[model samples]
Target chain A: MAVRDWEAVIGLEVHAHLKTRTKMFCRCELEYGAPENTRTCPVCLAHPGALPVPNERAIEQTIKLGLALDCGIAARAIFARKNYFYPDLPKGYQISQYEAPLAGRGRFRLPRPDGDREIGIVRAHLEEDAAKTVHAGGATGRSVGADYSLVDFNRGGTPLVEIVTEPDLRSAEEAVWFLRLLRQTIVELGISDAEMEKGTLRADVNVSVRRRGEEGYRPRWEIKNMNSFTFVGRAIEAAIRQQVAAHEAGEPVEQSTYDYDADTDRLTVHRSKEEADDYRYFPEPDLVPVEPPAELVERLRAELPERPADRIRRIEPAVGFDAAVELVTTGRDRLYDRLVAAGAEARVAANAVMNEVAAAGIDPEAVDAGELAKVLGARERLPRDVYLEAVARSADPGFAAAPFLEQEAVSDASALEPVVEAVLAANPEQVQTYLGGKEGVLGYLVGQVMRETRGKADPRVVNRLLREKLRA
Target chain B: MAIDREQLLHVAHLARLELRDEEVERLGAQLNDILAAVSKVSELDLSEVPPTSHPLDVVNVFGADVPHESLPLEEALANAPEREGSAFRVPPAGS
Candidate 1:
């Protein structure tokens, strides 16, 4: 697995089964865990003479993704048969796109913990999925002595959007973030559930490693069996490391499809390039070119929802406090929208949503952020006794956020500044202990005076005033 | 030149097409003719025409995320050639 005098280049082809109700090309319900092969039909099961009619919902879903990803619409898409013979494929050829994909040259921006990074989304295309097959035994599924195999059509015929990424990926962590962001975007767009654990989403990572300061990249080995984001990232790292060793040792790495062993976390050769060319592509003649009208595309584009990245950025500055905005921005936008819809100021709602509601798992719909937000934002219109109650327990968030005004005292501390100075000038006993950083005695003195002030003085102002006076 | 019979058989086997010798011999000549006929496209000034990936703009459009009913066991297993209860059994492999 050595790659000499080269750099590692990585690209990904991720297929996401849009959580749709029906198969992409048929009316068969796309419900999972149905009795195996029960959802099959002439069109879905690929019976001869059964032509695949495009699903309107599938088309619209793909278009919505294109819009969210900021990709141009493909007005005419020709479906070609990727000619391949396999036990899983009922039809000798799979209907897919080659010359014209649904959308291409798209880009997506991933939100990191600190900043946003842009990744090139090469293209998003439409294609029918093949049935599921269980290869028996070993890590290869067919590697060991096998007795038999199983087949499940429950997952078959699900419409998948194949998102191809540019080979611009550098590190494994970045790739993981990119996948997470993509999944998040799809979920936010309501386009796909994109659960990789459930096989609703899957990724194929292509990796090639080269030497440091090399001009050309090494012959990459395509890594497969990466079912999860962490797995994909780990596989890429392992592949790069393996190739780097090969390069350092002046050995060349061959182009191959390697399997990522999640248990031991290493790359094993699944099949070499010579053996991997079973995917014989040919134009599918039975399925005609899908040419949805241009006006339909226009309508979909017009109805496109604002992507999360765009929507989040616009909402951040609307709050006067940046932290409030930032905190709320991390949450589900639907919840935020509901809060705003329920007569909450975006800013106060943002704060209450982040600070108060998030900590508690109350069904947001049951207790909308608006009710608590109104109390916090409209304290002037609220009862004074309620505000006072909020001031009393300012130390405890649960106390302050008990659906009450959270403000406490600033007037008393400043008013007590002169009195505390006079007291300090007269005594000078507790001053040294306070100056020695054991300022706990200063609170005792301030509390005694504040109690004398009949709680009329602000406790915070009193504490500050007493502390300054004691300092002298 | 006559189509090479051995070369055609090799390709057919790789593609997993179980072809009779006569059918293979005929398809070999026919495919070469088709390829030779369509090779004229390369001679044309078609470099200016950018390839169209999809004619429609719908790639990511989705509906209100909701669930529907799955097929009943009997209905789901109706078409299976070999089924016990709700499962479809396949021919045993590696025998």
Candidate 2:
């Protein structure tokens, strides 16, 4: 059976840690590289007789993200206890939303090769992160071989918003594109850093493959704790191939959890279906149900920033599709917009930003929009090399392009005549070829003139002058 | 709606409790009685009444996002059953 004969259905659950001053329930400061257990508190450590109080700022941030995603915010949402036993979870049960999530039924659009496609978002709910468990004396430093483990409670109570998507994705490329847009949105809203390397943003992907016209979904296998987007794409492709092979061999694809080994490009079963724990969920008795006020919701909605898709649509006409995508995906569209507002030509500004600023490794925020506009506005007068050089130097503070601006290329026919005459005399063979109906050799004479003047002579004027001189 | 001995043992296992045969049989009956008592509320036709997860009528009870002083190292590790250098030592963790 060929690969295209089967359809792969993929869904993702992205967990982004909220950027707040303190932990979700406790007042312990949220520090990334702090010493182990330095941020622990009685509530976060799950000491007996300690109760949790909700953090208002975390709730507001979650609602802000939900609004940005166009999700329906739940007026009355309650946290439930997800019961399990793990060394990382000091409390036997984690406070999460099982039935009443904070937001639901949203749709996010991804720019696909075949236009844009909307991916359904099942829910985006708030939950507390678990502690970090470090296993030592193992080959992989994981819990596979001999050694005890140490627990770090500092990261235990950090606030996280888990965004779960419906099984609307069809290919691995689409999944990665959706994640990129989602990360951009989260970072734009100042919710989370969404840096996968720092462990703030992570995902667990569920994949299943069936025939093209299949109705319902088959039992899906979940790949857990994928930290990098590149690894996520590889894992999805590997899982689909594995499932398709199983179907071809008359073997069943069991519903289970698997861990993807990036080094080996293999999926190893972590836990079977029978071993899956029944997270006996119940409402958390300590925290009260969250009912956001109507006025608060409305205020947040009104203050929401423009969505990325809408920003792309507004700029796509001025800039081409590739430049528009580059601007929006890199989170530099705001800078581009500012340059446009400052009287810079949209198409020129887009090219300068995507080519010059990006290539110089200069931070977009560090570059002044007004200075960039001045440099790009003079693009027509300056040669391409000089224009690019000005764009690169615009990152320096208090630097103006006008001070170092070059004169316009020599376009006047009378001024360019001598240079054309010299080039026609030097490249006599090329001029002869041109007179013999080899019209392409005119470009060679034009290049020789521009090279003689150090790229200061306009090629268009040189072409006309050289044509008349050589014909004579 | 009857609680069997197998179900009782499963719940005990989930809660990390050991039970004998007689204890399982005895607890099964008690659980059944408690379920029966709670089942009476299900019989009421309170269709319009929204299910309440909390007894309080309040909502949005939260603290400000301000950092406060955490407990000292000694105090933070005071309640741990075992401890290592600046961390709590637990048994071998399963993946």
Candidate 3:
């Protein structure tokens, strides 16, 4: 069958690690790259008779995210034990939400190439992370050819929120856009860093292809533990091709879980449906149901920062599309808004931030917005080099651009004439060229005059003075 | 509800236990008996009552999100069956 004859149905399950100070069930420090097993406790290690105390901030952060995503907060959500055995899981089961989750039935609108399309979020539930496992004596460091493996409980019990989306995405591109917006929302709420490289935000993709206009979905194949957005897109594409080929060849596509090898760019089937684990889910008796106070939820909802889409819409007209998108997507629109509130011209501040600050690799928050506004306010008078320098220096504490602001463009004819005369005398060849109908030489002369005046002479003044001199 | 030998084996596999045939048969009967006793509660017709997952009267049981000193490296790895550096060593994992 032709590729266009089929439609791909895709859903994503994203796990975002919470940025709490401690583990979900214990006081162990929640950190990255700490000494192996150094953060473990009896509770996280699943020592006999040890009890778990849930982390309050994790719940608060989860609620904040749910409200940001417009999800309905459950009055009572139970934690259940997803029974499984893996070397990485010390408890032999993971504490997760199954029958009832913390929040459910939300919609996330992804800004698609066509338009805004809403993806239904089935649920966003809280869970604890498994430990890190390192495979030794393998070129890929995976279990396929490894001689042995080691487990580190340092990451165990880290609070995580798993968001499951409905099969609304039609292509790999849409899935990526949804993930990008979801990451932005999570980061904007200060819940998680959502860094793909750190494994803090990862996704499992479910993909299947059905004949166009078909009513029901076919059995889907799951691609597991994709760390990067690019990989997720590639895996989905590969899975779709595999499914289409199977259908075209008159073979049934097996429902299975596959691993995407980044180096080889291939999908290796890990387990089929029959081999899938039976995670006999039961309520975790150690912990009680989480019922966030109604007052707290209301407060979080009222204080929710304007979402990226709405903020971009509001600022697009003033800042233009590209700058507005950069500001919102990078979580720096707050700085832009503060600059505008501090009396900076909206368009000028937006351009200065997107062009100067962002280009210099400086965090928008590190730079003083008011000082940046002052620098941008003088954009017309200051040369591009001076403007960028001032922007970079503005990140220093107690920095003011008063001395640099003193240098204004020389627009008056009287002030610019002598500088233009000096430039003309230094380049008589350019004068002769301009007299011989090489009008472009006038630009070269004007550039010399501006350079002599240290970029303080207005180009218009220099151009007019040079033309009059050359004409004579 | 009936608990057969296959169901018992499946539960044992999920728990990562190896059960002999005779053990599976014995556990199946024992589990069926326990389920028969618990099945009486399912017959109650209290439609308005909410299902309770915990026996406690509390709703939210949480601690402040603050970090305390974690277990020392030695103590953290002390109970591991096999240790490599500071980590616990396990058999090579299979796909």
Top-TM-score structure, candidate number = 2
What are the candidates' interface root-mean-square deviations? 6.2, 1.8, 1.8
Model 1 spans with C-alpha error above 4 angstroms: A1-8, A111-117, A136-144, A271-275, A278-280, A311-355, A363-403, A406-472, B1-7, B18-85, B91-95
lDDT of 3 by residue, A140-247 (tens): 787767788899998999999999999999998888878988898898888999999999999999999999999998989999889998999899888888889899
Instruction: Give the winner by DockQ.
Output: 3
For model 2 chain A, give the 10-residue run with minimal summed lDDT. Answer: A270-279
For candidate 3, the chain B TM-score comes to 0.90
Screening candidate 3 with a backbone cut-off below 3 angstroms (N, C-alpha, C), the clashing residue pairs are: none
**CAPRI rating of model 2:** medium
List model 1 lDDT by residue over A246-318, tens digit each. 7677787888788888898889887432333555665455555556678777887787666656565666566
lDDT by residue (B68-90, candidate 1, tens digit) is 34455576556667654455545
Compared with the true structure, what per-residue lDDT tens digits does model 2 show for residues A240-266? 988998998989889889999888888
Shift in Å, residue A244, candidate 3: 2.2
Scanning candidate 1 chain A in windows of ten residues, the lowest lDDT window is: A391-400
DockQ score for model 2: 0.67
Q: lDDT for every model?
A: 0.67, 0.86, 0.85
| Colliding pairs, model 2 | none
- How does candidate 1 score on lDDT? 0.67
